[model samples]
Target: MVRERKFSDEDLFLATKELLLDYGYEGFTFGLLAERLGVSRSALYKYFGNKEELIMEFMMYELDQFMDKLRKINDYNRFEDQFDYLLELLMNHPQIHQLIEIGRHVPVNNQKLKEKNDKLDGLHLDMYQSLVGFVQQGKGEGKLKPHIPDTLIVGYILQSFLVPNFAQIPHSEWVQSIKEIIRNGMFTDDH
Candidate 1:
């Protein structure tokens, strides 16, 4: 009789995400993943053909989790509350943007990789729609200025995640300051 697998797909995906973030794509290896999961390298190959397949699957998994949280923003009655929730979501998953950047360079040498890239593109469209809807709602509710374009608002929100902290500010303070800057312009009322 065949033995049952010890770890679930979730277990593998979570471990892969951590390793990818720490080691990046160039450094990531099946050996490291197998060692981290307490499984043999061949055992991993049974699930994924190679690192690219594993990484693609992992990205899909992470995107699903992210989409779940993003959908919850609609439950809030106030745009301000939704905006705060959105900030928390983005800040909590700072590596998402990095993962996306990594995905850009992910070689598509097979049909499976092409399909995965197409699916990822669909997820990106869904995310963009959700963000646009949120911005539109904020504008209608007067929480966001009418003159500011939705694309600009969304871009600013996304770019905020990449802002450098050269001053070594505390995470809490940095987040709070970012929230303030996003909500209120940098210039004082006197200006």
Candidate 2:
């Protein structure tokens, strides 16, 4: 009979995110993960063959979490409400962007890792589909300007987190300011 794992996948994934963020992909190792999970390296081996498999699994968890929350944007009927919800959601996932970028660099030497990487790519497209739909909805409702390309709008909204917070503005205000700029141009109606 197989023995059960002492730690839950949720616990392991949480620790994985923390450790990966603290120490980059090259620096991350099973020894470090074992220490974080308070388990022996051999214990982890029972779950994954190597660090790559574990990291792929962890990325899957992250995508599932992000996609779950992203699906909720449909709950809000109004474009403004959807916009607000998305902004707030994006704010909460500040590190996710970086995490996803890291996932992109993970090498896929074997079939399993390749499959996981392909799934990750599919999920990314699904995310873009939702975001594009959101933009299209706004355009259809006259909430967003029709002249501007949907790709540009979607790209801006998606990359908003990349803007450096060098000014040290409060999070709420910063997000609000970004919303205003997206809704209305910097020059205002007068210009």
Candidate 3:
């Protein structure tokens, strides 16, 4: 007889995200997830065939949440405000970048996995599309340089998140410095 599931998906995904961020993909396992959820490993196995499947499922949830938050970029009227919001979101979810990189290691040996991977790639493009609109608006308003290509500007801003806070500087100061560099050129204004 099929036993009713004990945990809600919110609980499952929440636990999955925490574990994934804490231990990362290499360290994450169904046993760990089950233990975190206070359930038996067999209970998890009944839902997911293997660790990869469970991870992928959790990733889908994660991406959806991210996209929802990304959509809020339109809410900020000012170009700098939008840029700051995006940076804050990226900072708050730094693990997302690492998790996505780890996703490439997921073995897409079956149709389901392939489709999920494909969907993730598509979602990435969707995110870029939203950012492109933001960049285009900035160019139109003369807030961003028109000479530079939009793709490059978008790439620069997104890649800026990967910059390390090597000096262990305070958070607000570091973010402000990054914002200054992103808005103005690295050189002093006199240049």
**Winning model by lDDT:** 1
> What does candidate 3's lDDT look like per residue over 66-108, in tens digits?
9899999999999878887888988777666666767767778
Error of 1 at 102 (Å): 1.7
- Name model 3 segments beyond 4 Å from true: 1-15, 18-27, 31-41
TM-score, every prediction: 0.84, 0.83, 0.77
Poorest 10 consecutive residues by lDDT, candidate 3: 94-103
Q: Name every residue pair that clashes in candidate 2.
A: none
- Per-residue alpha-carbon lDDT of candidate 2 for residues 11-65, written as tens digits (9 for 90 to 100): 9999999888888888888899899888998899888888888998899889889
**Candidate 2 weakest ten by summed lDDT:** 182-191
Q: For model 3, what is the error of residue 44's alpha carbon versus the real structure, in angstroms, after optimal superposition?
A: 2.6
Poorest lDDT segment (10 consecutive residues) of candidate 1: 97-106
lDDT of 1 by residue, 1-191 (tens): 98888899989988988888788888888999899889999999888888788888888888888988888999998998999999999999877777777766678789999999899878878888999999999999988999988999998898888887898999999999899899887777786
Candidate with the larger TM-score of 1 and 2: 1
Candidate 3, clashing residue pairs?
Answer: none
Measured over all alpha carbons after superposition, the RMSD of each candidate to the real structure, in angstroms, is 2.4, 2.7, 3.2
